[model samples]
Target: MYAIIQKFHSGWAYIALLVLVIAVVNAILGMASKKEFTAKDRKIALFGLIVTHIQLLIGLVLYFVSPLGLASLGQMSDKSLRLTSLEHPFVVIIAIILITIGWSKHKKLTTDESKFKTFSIFYGLGLVLILSRLPWSLWF
Candidate 1:
């Protein structure tokens, strides 16, 4: 069960990251071109958001079950254990919150450029944060 959940979390990370990149790029392009926000644009962002949320849920479950997760929480002197048990999850949660805030803020904006800018700023930041905290050794 642990192995299955771990694999699922790892596999889903790829999809989540890909969609997030796409959304960020799309928003950047939309902002650069000063184009009117369209349904397609919204859908792209929504897709990214959905996949990320799913990934978060899978990760939460895996956290409790994986030895590298909560089980290693007190091993702060070990860089790998510290990252997997504490830093990685904490940063990712913050990134998700930023993404969620960006999505909500976009809904309240009246201008296309503003919406695109909001998404670009928030999602872009979230992606960067997630990238920074990823346990590269474990994933590869």
Candidate 2:
């Protein structure tokens, strides 16, 4: 169960990150070009939100079940264990929150530029945070 969940979490991250990157890049492009935010743009961002949320759910389950997750929380002397047990999950949660905020805030916005700007800033920050804490060693 732990191995399956861990694998799923690892695999789903690629899709989640890809969608998020697309959303951020699209938002940035829209803002720069002063393009009107259309239904397509909204859908793109929505897809990003949905994918990330799914990834987060998988990650949460893995965090509880995996030996390297909650079980290793007190073993912070080892950098790899510290990342999986503490830093990775912590930062990823915050990143997800930022992404969620960007989604919510964009809906309340009236101007297209404002919507794009909000997504660019928030999603971009979330992406950065997630990337920074990712277990690169385990990935490769």
Give lDDT per model, in order.
0.97, 0.95
Global lDDT for candidate 1? Answer: 0.97
Q: Model 2, range 1-140, lDDT digits (tens) per residue?
A: 88889888889999999999999999999999999999999999999999999999998899999899999999999999999999999999999999999999999999999999999999999999999999999999
lDDT of 2 at 22: 98
What is the alpha-carbon lDDT for the whole of candidate 2?
A: 0.95
Please give the RMSD to the true structure for each candidate, in Å.
0.5, 0.6
Model 1 alpha-carbon miss at residue 97, Å? 0.0
Best by TM-score: 1
Clash count for each candidate, listed in order shown: 0, 0
User: Candidate 1: which stretches are off by over 4 Å?
Assistant: none
User: Which of the numbered candidates is closest to the native, going by highest lDDT?
Assistant: 1
- Give the lDDT of residue 66 in candidate 1: 94
lDDT of 1 by residue, 54-129 (tens): 9999999999999999999989999999999999999999999999999999999999999999999999999999
